[model samples]
Each structure stands twice: as C-alpha cells, then as structure tokens.
Target chain A: MRGITITLASLLILTLISVVFANYAHGYMVFGILILAALKFIGISFCFMELKKAHSFWKVGLLLFLVLFMISVLFLAK
Target chain B: MESKILNHKNIYYPPGGILIWIIIFLELITFGIALIVMVFYGQKELEIFHTSRLQLNTTIGTINTLFLITSGYFMARSVSYLRKGQKEKSSLFLKLTMLGGLFFLGLKTIEYYFKIEAGLTVGHNTFFTFYWMLTLFHVIHVIVGLVILTSVLVGLRKNPSKVAIEDVEASAAFWHMCDLIWLLLFPVIYLLF
Candidate 1:
C-alpha cells in the first residue's frame, strides 16, 4: 500500500515535468522521461502485480523487456 | 497440479498465470507496433500531427492517467485485503476500482464528444486516425478489465475461501497491465508532441 502510493506520486511528478517541457525536451530528455515511465511500470509489476514473489527468470525478463523496448521506441521516434 | 505451481515456497509460475502474461505481452506488442507506425507517420506528416495534437485536451489525458493509477492502487489494496482474509473490505476496493474505470470512461467520452463536435473524426487526418485507433482500442481493454474485476469480485463474494490467491492476483495482473499500457500511451500520445 505504501509502495503503491509512493510510486503513483513519483509518476505524477515525472509526468508533470514531462508535460511542462513537452515542446522543448528533446533527444535524451525525452528518453529520460520514458525511462521514468518504464521505472513506474517495473514498480507496479513488482509491487502491485506481486512479481516480487515471481521467479527470478520473470523478473530478469521484465527488466530486459523494458530496456529493449524503450531503446527501440526512442530510436524509432528519432 | 494445474491450479498453480506452489511446492517449496518458490514461484515457478507467474502471479496471474503463464497464460495471462502471454496474452499481455501479445497485447503490448500489438499496441507497440501501432505506436511505432504512428511515429513513422508523424515524421512524414509532422505539421498535420502537431496541428491535430494541439486539438487534444492534455488536461483530460492527465486526469485519465491519474484515474487509471488510482484504480490500480485500489486493485492492489483489494489484493492485500484478500490476502489478509478481509473479504468485505476487498470487495469494496474492487468496486472502487471499477468506479475509477467508469469515471475514466466518462471523461474520455467527454473528450471525444468535443472532438467530434469540432469536426475531428477517425477519418479526419492521420493524427486523428491514430488517436481514435489507439484510444478506442485502449477503451476496449478498459471494458475487458472491468469485466475481469467484476468477475473476481463476484468470485470472492461467492466463496472467499475458494478464491485462490493466484486467481485474485491474476485478475490484478490483468488490471495493472491495462494501467501500464496507458502509462506508456499517455506520454507518447498526449505529451510527446
């Protein structure tokens, strides 16, 4: 419960930052914002979805998916 | 043996189940491809994309993001409550989660109503095309999620003891996946412009 609240609050903050500079933020700045989104994604998966009790392989796979997907989409955006 | 893999206290199977995650990954890939294609089109028609993007309500998108997150939080609370054997509290949270989803749909409908009134439709332009496709598709998922949540709630009420933790967690996993997809979409579709 505490963890979910903290994650949502942090995500809201990151979202505010991203929207404030939506026009000007470029390249790595955009990537950084997306990385934050991915972080929240991982957090929800672990804490909310109860992936913390999941197997090691699932955890590693999710991390790998986040990294690879973010990098690919950013490249495509570029 | 088919219920859920639980032997020596180590999780070999996923929270919801292996099947749901497979469905989730497939859904993500579908949305991902659509988004990538949208990006490529945006590059080609940058002016049209930007102009159409300006027509969208960023505030609404932001609010919807909060709605989804709050609903997800309620879902997590429900799961925890169930784990503690608090069926009634868990049931209340499930209803709250569904309320969150319904509110999101209400706001989304308002946004769409304004867009349609302003001469923006799926066939309006490339940007509107992507807008309708991505968002409407997402709306369908939300509906599916509501169904999933409703079923889980009913199951809990019928027989909380029979309601396995894996079963509840599976429903929760599907709900959170909806949240995750929107989180990915909210930034890229709404704010990235």
Candidate 2:
C-alpha cells in the first residue's frame, strides 16, 4: 500500500511537471513531456503492476519497449 | 504439475501470468505502431495537425489522465487486498476502480459530444481521423475492461474464498493496460502535436 501510494504520488508529480513544461517551457516541450510520460509509465509498470517482482526478462523487455518508443517519437518529432 | 508450476515463482509467470502479459505486449505494440503512424502523418500535415490538436481540450485530456491513473491505483489496491484475504476491502476498491472508469467515460463522452457539435468528426481531416480512431479504440478497451472488472467483482461477492488470485490479477492487468495505453496516447495526441 505504501509503495502504491508513493508510486501514485510520483506519477501525479511527473504529470504536473509535464503540464508545466507543456505550457510554460516552449523549447523541448515535447522532449520534456515524453520523458515525463516515460517515467510515469515505468512507475505504473514497476510498482503498480508489480513488474518489479516479475522476472528480469519481462522487466527488461518492458524497459526496452519504452526506450525504443521514446527514441522513435523523438526522432520523428525532430 | 501445471498448477504447481503456476503457483511457483517461475520466470515465465508475471503477476498476471504469461498469457495476459503476452496480450498486454501485443496491445501495446499495436497502439505504439498506430501512434508512430499518427506522428508520421502529423509531421507530413503539420499545419492541419496543429490546428486540429489545438481544437482539443487539453484540460479535459489531463482530467481523464487523472481519472485513469487513479482508477489504476484503485485496481492495484483491490488486487493487494484480495491477496491478503480481505474480500470486503478488495471489493470496495474494485468498485472504486470501476467508478473511476465510469467517470472517464462520462467526461470523454462530453468531450466527444463537443467535438461532434463543432463538426470535428473523423472525416474532418487527417488529425481528427487519427484522433477518433485511436481514442475510440481505446474507449472500447476501457469498456471491455469495465465488464471484466464487473465480473471479477461479482465473483468476489458470490464466493470470496473461491476467487482465484490469478483471475483477479489478470483482470487487474487488463485494467492497467487501459491506463498504460492512455498514458501513451494522452501526451502524444493532446500535447505533443
């Protein structure tokens, strides 16, 4: 429960950060928002979904997916 | 032997088991490809994409994000409680999770209504096309997720002792998939372009 609470708080904070960057920070807004989204994604996966307790294979695979997706988004956005 | 394998902490078995994880991965990949395609087209029609995106209500998008995230949190709690043999608490959290989903659908319906009133249908343009396609598909997933959760809730109510943790975990996994997909979609569709 504590873990999930912390995860939820972290996600909310990351979301707030993204919103702030989207509105106030003009340059690298996309970059910042996507990065924050990635963090939120990891938080939900590891803590909320209990991926942290899962096999190393699944954890690493999920991380790889996120990294590849982020790279693609950034490259395309550029 | 198979039950023992499932009960043991094997590398193949995730929280929700291998099958659901496979489905989750497939779903994520599908959405990822669609998003990449949407982004590619957005670059091609930058002006149209930007104008259409500007028509979107970012505030509503953000609120819906909050709703899904909270819903996911509730679901995690539900599963946790069930594991601890606290059926009542688990049921309560499960209901809260469903409520969160309902709230999301309600707000999304309102947003969709406004978009339709403004003539922002799927045929409006390229941007609207992707918007409707991706979001409507996601909405369908959320509705399916709700049905699954409802069934789980009923099972818990009917026979708590007979409820399988694996089943609850599977349902929770599916619910979180909706949250995960939205996390991917919201920023890209609403904020990125």
Candidate 3:
C-alpha cells in the first residue's frame, strides 16, 4: 500500500516535469523527447505493473507487434 | 498465495484469445495498407500533407499520451490488487483508470472543436482524414475498454471469484495494448510532420 502511494506520487511529479520540458521542445527535439518520455513511462509500467513478469508469449508477441508498428511508422515518415 | 501465481509450465490456448488475435492481425493489416497508401499520397503531394498537419495540436496529443500510459499502469495495478483480494484498492485503481480515459476523451473533444474552428474537417486533406480516423478509432476503443473495466469493478463488488480476477487481468491487458498503440501514434502523427 505504501509503495503504491509512493509510485503514484512520483508519477504525478514526473508528469509535471515532462510537461515543463515538452512545452519548450521544437523540430527533431520534439519527437526525440517524446520518445524518451514514452520509454520512461513504459519502463515504469512494466516494472511497477508487473508486465515484465507476464507470460513469455505475451512478451514476445508485444515485441513483434512493436517491431511491425515501428517499421510502418518509419515507412510513412520516410 | 500459491494459487494466485499462474502456472508458467503450460499456457492454455483459449479459443477466445485466438479469436481476438485474429481480429488484431486483421486490423494490423488494415493499418499497414493505410500507412502505405498515405506514404504514396504524401510522396506525390507533400505540400498538402504538411499544411494538414498544422491543424494538429502537439501539446494536447503529448498530454493525452501520458494520460493513457498512466491509465495502463492503473489498470495493471488494479488487477494486481484484485489478485491479492484487496477489493478497495482494486476499485480505486480501476476508477483512476476510468478517469484517465475520460481525461483523454475530454481533451480529444476539445481538439475536435479546434479542428472544426480551423476548418480542418476529415475532408480537408489526407492527413486530416487519417488523423481523425486513427485517433477517433482509438478513442472509441478506450471508451469500450473503460466500460469493460467498470463492469469488472461491479462484478468484483457483487460476486468475485478467480474467474472474475482472470477476466479483469485479460481486459486490462487489452486496455494496455490500446494505450500502447496510442503511445506510438502520438509521435507518429502529431509530433512528426
């Protein structure tokens, strides 16, 4: 219970911090920072939410899905 | 405690899971085609695409991404609490997740209003059309996921069981996938021109 409370509090803090930084970014820096914040949030979700310990199939399936998604996004961006 | 830990030695191949995967695979194909078509269209007409992108509000999209990502965490934690038989904690987290969905939807509606005010309807250009289609599709999904999660909370209150617990976990996983997809889309469509 206490740990959950601390995690939620930190999330709120991190969000505020990200928002402050996000407001100033422009051009390539914008997408770059968004990706960084995204990776950070995913890390927190996986670690604190126990998604890392989910089934191996799920983990591998998620990786495959991400790969395909990235390829499509990059294809369009080009 | 022991029973709560799902067995890793054998993964069941449920028909429902398989069916859902089929649907997801189909959607993936649709998105792939859409991406390819948009790329071709953009290659032939770059100016129109760039102008259409100016209609989007990057700040709102970024904020919504954070909102849904946090919601995914809440949904996952809700399941973890339910697994531990902490009904109140589970309900609280589920409610928080629902609020996250509401928050995203609220911001999206505001964005829609801006697009309308700027005369950026779906018919404006290919980018506008795809933007509205993709995000609104995701918005509908987040709403559906919220409904399922709310029902799970109600079930937990009425007659909780291991099956209810598993249902909540599976539903949360689906919600997380939805959230993650939006996380990827936020940058793809909104941040990048």
Candidate 4:
C-alpha cells in the first residue's frame, strides 16, 4: 500500500516537472523519460503483478514482443 | 474430483487464468508499438510539442493518475480478499475500480474539449497529431477496461461464484498497465511539450 502511494506521488512529481518545461526537453531528455517510463512499468509488472509466478515462456514472449514492436515503430517512424 | 479452489490449505494446479494473461500481454505489445511510432515521427517537432505542453492541465492528469493508482490498490486488496473468501469486499473493490475508470474518461473528455478549443487539433502538426492520437488511443483502452470491469461487477453481483476471480485480477493488472503508460505519457506530452 505504501509503495503504491509512493509510486503515485513520484508519477505526479514527474508530470509536474514535465509541465513546467514540456517544450524544451530534447531527445536526450526524452530518452531519459523513456527509461523512467520503462522502469515504472517493470516495477508494476514484476513487483506488483508478481510476474515471477507466471510461466517463463510468457515472460520471454513479452520481452521479445516489446523489443520487436519498438524496433518496427522506430523503423517506420518519421 | 471435488472442487479445486485456492483456499487456506488447498491450491489448484495450472490455474485456469493463464489465458487472460496472454491477452493482456498482447494488448500491451500493440500499445507499445503505437507509442514508439508516435514519438519517432514527432521527434522533429519537439519545439511545438514543448510549447503545446503548457496548454494541458497537469493537475487533471495528476488527479487521474491518483484515481487509477487508488483503483490498482483496491484491485490488489480485492484479490487478497477473494483468496480469503471475502466476496462482498472483493466485489465492492471491483465496483470501485469501474468508478475510477469512469472518472478518468470524464476528465479526458474535458481535456479534449479544452485542447480543441485551443486550436490543438490532431492535424495541426506532427506533434499535436501524435499527442491527440496517443492519448485517444489510451482513452479507448480505458473504455475497454471499463467495459470488462463492468461485466465483472455485474457477474459478481448476480453470481460471484461463477465469475473467475483470477480473471478479474488479470484484467485489473492490464488496467494498471494502461495507467502506468499514461503516467509516462501525460508528463511527456503535457509538461515537456
């Protein structure tokens, strides 16, 4: 419960930080944001959802899917 | 063969809820792809993206995030309650989750109206296009989640026993994933625009 609250707090702070200077951030900063986003998702999946209990095949499948999808999106991106 | 359930001392094998997990995973993959494409295409218009960020109301975004987080907490609690055979508490939480979904959609609609009035249409530019598309895509998922949650709630009320509690948990997990994605997106689009 406490952890969930903390996550929510951090999310708010991040949103505020972005709103404060939403326009000036460059690719480097965007990359940092992406990392933060990925980390948050990982926390929820592994910590909260207990992905460890899930089958190894499904876990691998998810990782592979993300990788491939991201690559495709970047490949076709403007 | 007697009843196979996860009680105080009896745990079932090969839980029948695995299929739902696969569905959630697939949906996440689709959303992730869309996110990457939007960011990639809109990279050149980072300036407009930043300027437009000011137009969005961060407070609303924060509120929605908190609402979803609370829902996630309730979802986790409801699962625990289910394991303990506390049906009423579990159903209540499920209903609460649905309410959170509705609240988010309402705020999103208001946000959209504000954006349209501010001359931030999807076709305005690459940045605005991605902004509207990505957020709306997310909104669609939220709607889907709300529908699934409503079904679960209705089932819980009519015949709680027939409804697969684990399946409910799985749906809630996907809903949280959607929430987490927006937690990242709201800041990236609105704050840093």
Residue ranges of candidate 3 with Cα displaced over 4 Å: A1-51, B1-5, B8-40, B161-163
lDDT tens digits by residue: candidate 2, B1-193: 0112263246778999899999999999999999999999999999999888889999899889999999999999998988777889999999999999999999999999999999999999999999999999999999999999999998888877677888889899999999999999999999897
TM-score of each: 0.91, 0.96, 0.77, 0.76
Model 4: per-residue lDDT, tens digit, B5-118? 543111221122565565666767666666666556556666665566656687787677667766666666666667677889988877787788888889989988988998
DockQ of each: 0.57, 0.72, 0.23, 0.26
Q: Please, what are the lDDT tens digits per residue for candidate 1 over residues A1-78?
A: 788778767766766676766757665666766776787788778877777877887787777777777777788667
Better of 1 and 3 by lDDT: 1
Q: Indicate the DockQ of the complex predicted as candidate 1.
A: 0.57
DockQ, ranked from best to worst: 2, 1, 4, 3
lDDT (tens digit, per residue) of candidate 3 on B94-146: 89988998999999999999888988888887888888888778787888888
Write down the worst ten-residue block by lDDT for model 2 chain A. A14-23
The local distance difference test score of each candidate is 0.81, 0.91, 0.64, 0.64
- Model 2 ranges with Cα > 4 A deviation: B1-9
Number of backbone collisions per candidate, in order?
Answer: 1, 0, 0, 11
What ranges in model 1 sit over 4 Å off? A23-29, B1-12
